[model samples]
Target chain A: MNKRELAKRVAEKCGQSQVVSTLVINTFISCILESLEAGEKITIQDFGTLSVKQQKKRERFNLATNKVETYLPYDYIKFTASKSVKIKQKEKSVKKE
Target chain B: MNKRELAKRVAEKCGQSQVVSTLVINTFISCILESLEAGEKITIQDFGTLSVKQQKKRERFNLATNKVETYLPYDYIKFTASKSVKIKQKEKSVKKE
Candidate 1:
């Protein structure tokens, strides 16, 4: 589902106005963005974990030109779903099959 | 940050009561869970995308016993952060260095 649909559902489930729900959802998104930007990880239990994983700097050679280049180290966010969620996902596939 | 802390921040940012915010947060979690359970993907733009990725079934060998075992195909959720967030994270690293 997309953000609008998801926001609508959240508003209904929480009995909040859509406008307010939109703000809350956006705030939550910004909060996560800020956290990751500050080098902190956000862990919402049973949902999943969002954290930045480090990528090492290294040198790579171009196969075609036979030239070497250096790459800088960086970090990227990684998400790992909880085991319960994983099981639920698998159960759906099993039922379909 | 953990759930409680994140919830508090969300509540403050949205100017919602903590009790209600908790419900909203939990509901959002359940919404995502239900979506994935039904084999649907949840895409929250700017923050990241959450979707199920498939893994192919394969056979693996036990190095010690030399016994082969079959593994069933399955799906798992994956998250990809937005480019803006990636840039923000990198900025923090640059500042620290």
Candidate 2:
């Protein structure tokens, strides 16, 4: 399902209009991205944990060039699904402090 | 940040009460988890794309046991960040079909 369909579901569950649901979801997305970009870890209850991991600079052989290439460090997204994930868990939301 | 803190930020941004905001955010999380569990790919505009990827069975050498172990296939979550992820882009919501 896409965002619109997801928004509709959320709106129905929360008894809110789609517009408002979408707005709140948008804000949430922004917050998550901002937090992750700052190298912060976020753990939601039913959902898994999300964090940014960095890779160290490494050297690899370039087959095409037949030369050793050094790759600079980079950041990537990592998600760990909650071990307790279940249909029943859907009612439960993000993990709390 | 934890869920409560995230909810507070979302509430402030959407001008919704903390209760309503939390409810909406919870619903959204549930929807996302359900979709992902069902092997659906979800892409939010400013955020990123999420999908379930299957890992093929593989063999790995166990140094402790000094033996080769076979691993079964499994599904894992994958998130790909958007190309246009920016602070300003947060204003935009999920990607549209």
- A30-86 in candidate 1: lDDT tens per residue? 888788778788889988888877777789998988999878878888888767665
Tens-digit lDDT string for candidate 1 (B2-79): 988988999998898788678777888888777877778787888777877777778999898899987887888878
Among the numbered candidates, top TM-score falls to: 1
Candidate 2, residues B29-59, lDDT tens digits: the string is 8888888776678887767787777666789
Predictions: Cα RMSD each? 3.0, 8.4
Across all candidates, the chain A TM-score values are 0.80, 0.80
Q: How well does candidate 1 score on lDDT at residue A15?
A: 87
Q: Which stretches of candidate 1 lie above 4 Å from their native place?
A: A87-92, A95-97, B87-92, B95-97
| DockQ (CA atoms), all models | 0.61, 0.34
TM, every model: 0.86, 0.80
What is each predicted model's overall lDDT from 0 to 1?
Answer: 0.79, 0.78
Query: Number of the top candidate by lDDT?
Result: 1
Off by over 4 Å in 2: A86-97, B86-97
